[model samples]
Target: MVPVRDELFARLERFYDAIPRDGAHTEAFGGLVLFVRDGAGWPFYARPRLDATEPASAADVADVRRRQRELGLPEAFEWVHENNPELLAVARSAGLSVLEAPLMVLDPTALPSVTELSDVPVRLLDPAAPTFGADLAARRAVAAVGFAAPGTAVGGAGPAARDTALVELPLDALAEEQCRTESGHRISALAELPGQGAVASGMAMRVDDAAEIAGIATLPSARRRGLGAAITAALARRLLADGVDLVFLSAGSTEIARVYLRVGFRRVGTACIAEPA
Candidate 1:
């Protein structure tokens, strides 16, 4: 039987598989898949967020802990999102704490007007900048207080530091985009499936339902001008044309949620995060 929220996640899983994975770090723990960019020490960590079949118990925690040790992931980086209350209990038992998170969506058709983007321009970046270094540091000062924040909080922190750490790790091939003002300052940026000249996506080890929308951010000076909404819509449109039906992304606030809702995406559910202290 199809579990509740499975279709949404199934779409994500399929998208994940569709993309190439030759440039990022990956670790499999149980049935959970954790992906990280090599250049950014540890800014983003993605796994299949879903409800658990069995209640998280001591044994489950122990098993996860063992998996972590074997995979070399920091205990602090471990997290879980599930509708099963028992799963939350299991995470607590394993020293993880839950944070309130909301999943937001938007329909591509309803996306607001972006013609106001006269001052700001978005362009694809070449030799894609490392995700966890200078590019990320550039936004911390401007990012929203608790929301629209990437790095560290949701793992998109320290562009330089994380990028260095990811230098040697095996990472999936990546594509990058930057939100820049007319003055030539990049305010926000994003990384998606690399669109390098003719590379086989299957060789990229792309997961079947996982097209990770990584490092989405906008600069302080570029806010309120519809840059974010425009870029997001552009990405969504591209993906849909490429034959992707559903896209998955996590939001840090209602404001960001509003932008997404204006676009054509609908919420399937919440993606809760539990981090180890």
Candidate 2:
């Protein structure tokens, strides 16, 4: 098996590189937002930005700090466009605290069966179905309301719209083994990405067995019931059974991260955001 850290990093790199290249950027938000912006969202391998305040060889830590504050970029984030030790060191000096690292695991042998929850109901929705329209909106609305309490200005409404557009592509990429399950009408979870005939996270838009969690949500009224964990475990078991070899995902919150951990995931690395100095 590949080293856990290496696998996780490679998975993340694939995701960062896979963002649509036409007109936008996928900013993986956190203490350090990963800015994967390009026409093609190609993964950042190792290239230095000419906009840096100093040469990569003599990078001034203070320059990174100034640029971060000036641009309002996350205090801590990696400019994955290039790979340089000094770049990371400079960002660290600027108050960008480390958070949970990304993680990945290979399960070529398949995941164990997940016991069904007797109490909660699970629903599966077709990503291509027109009825799927309001589902994304509703989920984002609930997410917006949830994030508001934490003092963040996240507009789930927008992602909901973008999600509607991406669904067709990501769904098409999902393997037949990819399946979705939700807990009752209150919380829904889908393997969104397909991997190895099963749903895995991080594989979307281009290949199979590279599944992404596509979407997961709980009704505002149903928060705190642990429905999230139930849905995740159920999904994991189903995907594993389908022959998924590895799985990867990004967490929006520590709470979500903990739940995923309970389902057999471990942390690998974290990303950060930076801007031109």
Candidate 3:
């Protein structure tokens, strides 16, 4: 039988291509492809497909940078696999910073039994529910705190600075967007703490028949209590039950990756995010 990873990788590539651009233009230069949405709340980046050739030339890098500048978007590139050393070298030489994360996929046959942590009830939020407004506030608060915590991969700022920025976001709108099941995503959170609100939360985005689990976090005060794993497992189980063929996520670190591994997620490939130098 063929490797499951190859099939999943292909599905991922198709998923990226199918992302509704909402009128944004996409152009391909050799093996590199760029998506430009004019900063319309959609991702704008250059990416190399899994079957791309080696030795991404300096000219290719320059062309990508030129297009990004013309669109007035920051220069960013994403390499979905580790097979692009040549492209990565070209990107880095041109002053693009890189962050590498391990891509992980869940093995349904190996899934561990879901065990809810005591006193930490995990709740799936319904965007249409009467209490959605309050629940959304609590969910956003937990996310702000979790992402701002020291050593988080996404937030590079100090806690105070990150908190200030996160609080200013249009969270009401965000909550509305995330809670819409018709929008192909779902949000879940752990029970509220006495003063900290929701202590753990995560969301899943459906791409074709596969689901990408993202934004999983546990507040600092709730760390080490298995709340993170509990929420993750719960989300995975629900997605599988809903007929999602594949579920994957990019772990922020080996420590975080280990958490998913305990729940049957296997290492599949490397995921890279490149930003302007």
Clashing pairs in 3: none
- Location of the lowest summed lDDT over 10 successive residues in candidate 1: 197-206
Quote the RMSD, in angstroms, for model 2.
Answer: 10.4
lDDT, model 1: 0.42
Tell me, by TM-score, which candidate is best. Answer: 3
Q: Rank the candidates by TM-score, best first.
A: 3, 1, 2
Highest lDDT: give the candidate number.
Answer: 3
Q: How do the candidates rank by lDDT, highest first?
A: 3, 1, 2
Query: Model 1 over residues 53-101: C-alpha lDDT tens digits?
Result: 4444555455555665565755433232433345556567777775644
The TM-score obtained by model 1 is: 0.55
At residue 217, what lDDT does model 3 achieve? 77
Global lDDT scores for all candidate models: 0.42, 0.40, 0.68
Q: How displaced is residue 213 in candidate 3, in Å?
A: 0.6
Q: Which stretches of candidate 3 lie over 4 Å from their true place?
A: 1-3, 20-25, 38-42, 49-56, 70-72, 82-85, 113-119, 137-141, 150-180, 186-191
What TM-score goes with each of the models?
0.55, 0.50, 0.78
Candidate 1 C-alpha error for residue 67, in Å: 5.5
lDDT (Cα) of model 3? 0.68
- Could you tell me which 10 consecutive residues in candidate 2 have the lowest summed lDDT? 195-204
